[model samples]
Target: MALSRYDGCGETKLDCVSPGGVCFDPRFVGGDGVTFYFHGRKDQDFCLVSDTNLHINAHFIGKRNPNLKRDFTWVQSLGIMFDNHKILVGAQKTSKWNDNVDHVVMSFDNTTISLPPNEGSKWNSLVMPSVTVTRTSNTNGVMVEVANNFKVIATVVPITAEDSRVHNYNITDEDCFAHLEIGFKFYNLTDIVDGVLGQTYRRDYVSKTKVNVPMPVMGGQQRFSTSSIFATDCSASRFGLNTNRRDGVAEYPILHCSSGMKGSGVVCKK
Candidate 1:
């Protein structure tokens, strides 16, 4: 979502305008589908997707602009932490956007998936489950999703604007950048879940973490990077479990905790 300022009277004040006199600010603008606008060069992390089963953080690359007296930022990479696996997917540096080449790289649990840039490339495992890389209909973006589920996990779309060029800001290179949009939907998720971003489908849920980190750098070089480290402390609440029996009697199985209990296993509770 685009960031905007409110006056003392609680009215939004116009910040920047495009060459066509269009007021431009960080905002989530649209009806059916919306685009989030973010300013860059903050050494902070934004948790775009946070659920009991999934945690995705968007690291924005930001640089300062003395002429504009503001920081211009773009999403550099996404840090996805799910189950017991951690993956990082990001675009390589480029001077302009290319529709043919896939500059994205995905690292699964410290092992990089070495595959040529093509459609229908898939990655699967017990820890991270299934991930498929495919080209968008317009061939201008990349769509990463869960295999056979038809649910999009993440996306990279090209940024188009006359003022969006690298020369307009204090970036280290003259390459253009793209925006990152993510939607996290895990399989077999229960209602009672806890996360930093809260439940994905809950209307009243709000993100508990901050999206922007304000770190002033001279040029437009990335200030910080995310590691492969991740944690899966998620546990479904037992209160949501069905324990009522027709005969008015219920039984609960004793849980056996072992060193490897953190891994996948089915628990039988009667």
Candidate 2:
């Protein structure tokens, strides 16, 4: 895979630097092992990965760059749908950077969730034991999981004053542009998976980005756009189309994930 230095993501600890990562300025390390950027418009929602029993959409937020034709967007939140469930993980808007604060937010099936700002703290859904949210750090980091189907490891971060000065982002004192840096892992994706990142996992899929350039990017914005963050209406969406569901409900694998000495508290099987 040919790659130009400028087309790559910025280095950040615990960021999904691996193939499934999404980081600085919305750069992605696709499943094909290629690094690229996708500047979906701020205030819009786009599909990242979609498969038969799973669908993931991202909500973007950013400030328009005066020097560029496009906005410098970041992933503000994730909207996920599987079977009859809807889950959300997002970064709360903030005016200043505070490492001591917890700014991550989450919801399950429309019910808001709260967890202690202590490392290793966790919450389990009594309605569905298979679903869980665990704090990967004392603040601003989390791991959300659904058995063996998928996991989203995320951390809430703010664009520092230095970033604003260097990038000329015109960030204001009232909004520091707090956003999420996330990585994903999928265990049982089908062959028909499709979306910005999902397509790269396909055995026969070919990337359309110019990898050798300074900034490679994936196109076809319209195909991945969704009306709402949780809507499974993207054109390339393969979610909920599986025949394996029973009575319109999907059953997932019973595997589990844990944390310890590897991968920065990422999903590790129990």
Highest TM-score, which number? Answer: 2
lDDT of each: 0.39, 0.78
Residue 82 lDDT in model 2? 86
lDDT of 1 at 252: 11
Q: lDDT tens digits, residues 1-270, model 2?
A: 111113332221354545577887888866655677899899999999888888999999998877888999999999988889999999999997889989998999999999988887889999989898988789998888898687678889999889889978888899999999887766667668888888877767777888667677888889999999988899998987754422211111232333223232223221
List the candidates' TM-scores in order.
0.50, 0.84
Error (Å) of candidate 1 at residue 57 is: 0.8
